[model samples]
Target: MSSGIMKRRPLKAADDKVHDFLTTGIGRVKALIRGSVKGFAKEHRPRSKNGRTAKAIFAEAQSPTDEDGNEIMIQVKKLSKIYGRRPEEALALLREGKDKGEVQSMTSNNVGLYDVSFDIRKGEMFVLMGLSGSGKSTLERCMNRLIEPTSGQVFIDGLDFTSLNDEDLRIARREKMSMVFQNFGLLPHRNVKDNVAYGLEIQGIPESERLERAVASIELVGLAGYGDRMPSDLSGGMKQRVGLARALATDPDILFMDEAFSALDPLIRGDMQDELIRIQSELGKTVIFVTHDLDEALKLGDRIALMKDGRIVQIGTAEEILQNPADEYVDRFVKEVDRSKILTANLFMRKPKNILYETQGPRTALRMMDNCDRDDMLVIDGEKRLIGMARSDGILRAMNAGDRDISGIVSDVPSVRPDTPMSEVVQIMVTTDFPIPVADDDGILLGMISPSAAAETLRNGGGE
Candidate 1:
């Protein structure tokens, strides 16, 4: 009887606390608290007619586009989530120049997110990164409507997700997106095949079709022969692979992975990260990955959103973030990161100033190299495609021999792609000659990476 009373006592105290806050106005208190609970519960409940109608949240603003002009897949605009009985008061305080800590201290309200806005491009691997309490997970949940936002909008491929009716949202989740959680959420009693096919089963897919899709997904994740094994029989990494296969089985356009590989051992985690990169490259799926590890984010993200105190402090590629940190906080956050791995050849490469045409005479090549004060000049063909290097000695020899064109004097030189890592570039520079040519797939000379430029970039921890 006493234990029962003890458990009920906490509930009674909670009611009393609500009653005390009711002095502010019973209707307002009830509405705010009830709405918060209902909104959260509505995420998992069946279709409800009470869900809000869609609105044109981005009608006044332009939708963001990628560098390749790819359409935006996910756009979050001024999204916020405040958890408290007096959320309105907390929100008011937040808007009046108060930080999350200050607002929480004043009103005892936890501000999970505040004014978060960003656009994720289609087929981009976008990362949300921060410390434990920085609200990265909260932001991800808000984007997917797992946790209802206090205010603002989320647009999925131009469709407003926030205003979606329960049935529409559920259907959208089923068809347009899927999530991979940190902890493997496999059903304990189900075999690997059944677990992978769970999403298809939910959609009432034919049993044979779902099983076929599940087997393909399993094979894709490198778990081909483990279909009959239960979740309990799999190792941790294998379990994670099963989880990934399950998410991929549905073939969702957008994959929301929240700290998905944080649980595995270091070696296994690295393998999973590599596998994810390969898979993403092959599938070209838009991934919104959440992580606290800066290295992991730097390695995987096409662009990263760094959050602090429930707000995005910065958003950029790894090189951009490392080279040009937005603020002191961001600077500190990336201070210890290995720049060699993050910096690329394209970032530090210089324009090819002493370029010689392959059709030009040896004298012309020599003159150009002299003008640029360079020992060697990069020779290009008629189409501006890189041919090779023309050293001063080679040009001089060719001129002495009365050669009509510098093409014969041009020698094959080691070259690297623009996206090559700085570490590999440095190694090439060490083993080969200075002023390595940076070229594209078609051998078009994009730029040059000089030894001095590489040295300075490494020393200063940035690029030109």
Candidate 2:
């Protein structure tokens, strides 16, 4: 299997079956029981000596699964939305490759979305980001069927949400989806507790049960004592919390947030972002968040779908977008981003070519340096734990000194964890002549990040 990271592929039927089995508790239990029975029947099972499971091997081979192993919570295919009296005609013009503005001008209709398609995976904070009129919010609205899409299909867990009738769609909205909007959509007359309980109330939940759920949700959003206060009394951030609590009170599987944090002050917005992360970590709900601020999108999104002029231009993780922009628009979007804070050692590091084990003699080390045409080599123990650095001169000196092993000539080298951000990595790189080593918590040598790689990554961010 190649060591390089793999791009995600569309799910196959077999992959979907495996995903369903793994995601469902009953299916997982059945599989575990079956494995145990087979093990008992054979009295033993063969284990890989390297300690990797079959699934892990397949994943390393980049077979049909995403690296995060998240299930698809929502899937949108060829989604396009047009506005105006005759949207169907406008959609036909769009399908003919007419420019959005041209189609709208020629048909006297407005384009709200332009063939936007993507997936929101389970437990992932997927972000929709774009300037106003870019169709980010429109796309988000279409996901929950708040705005009917003129053309395209929306599948929620393999069920076509766009195909559902109004009654069934209403039921699905109540039981499966919850939305938080940019404006704190709170009822002005109602107190915070009542506002939070409104969704449950709409669902016809009993008063006591609804209030209990609402209170728990209010507390979850850090508005425990502020529940009794009216929206008028609470600050903007607090009111937004009420909105969050209201949406969460229903405990729906999918969350749709359209600019939910854009109204708050910067400090409060940062706090809310962190709070959302904490809550999402605990709850593991599938979240589709909409934002216009690039910083906010980078900070909050697990994967961002950047929209431009009613079309999705790019979709990727922050690092992926920074390191490999899809086009000039994407290039401009990431131009001002601080690569040091977003790029990690894992992304910047390259595989080590020549390694010297501690058990090898100085002569062996020198020979490798000549063959690999390198001045220095990383020294590791038998278990691949990086211990030190060995220079060609040092190896020769050790050999001349009659040392049996190169361990005597080994020197301490700078190292970092795989996830260490490039912000700190640059400081370490400038002080060391050697390529920085990337290791895990256990000190196992994983890869090397040369100074040139760091420079290249920064340059890719449109920096020096």
Best by lDDT: 1
Cα shift from native, residue 158, model 1 (Å): 0.4
* CA shift of 454, model 2, Å: 24
Q: List the candidate 1 regions with Cα displacement exceeding 4 Å.
A: 1-68, 336-464
Poorest stretch of ten by lDDT in candidate 2: 56-65
Model 2 gets an lDDT of 0.84
Q: Model 2 segments beyond 4 Å from truth?
A: 1-69, 336-464
Cα lDDT over the full model 1: 0.87
Q: Name every residue pair that clashes in candidate 1.
A: none
Model 1 TM-score, all chains together: 0.61
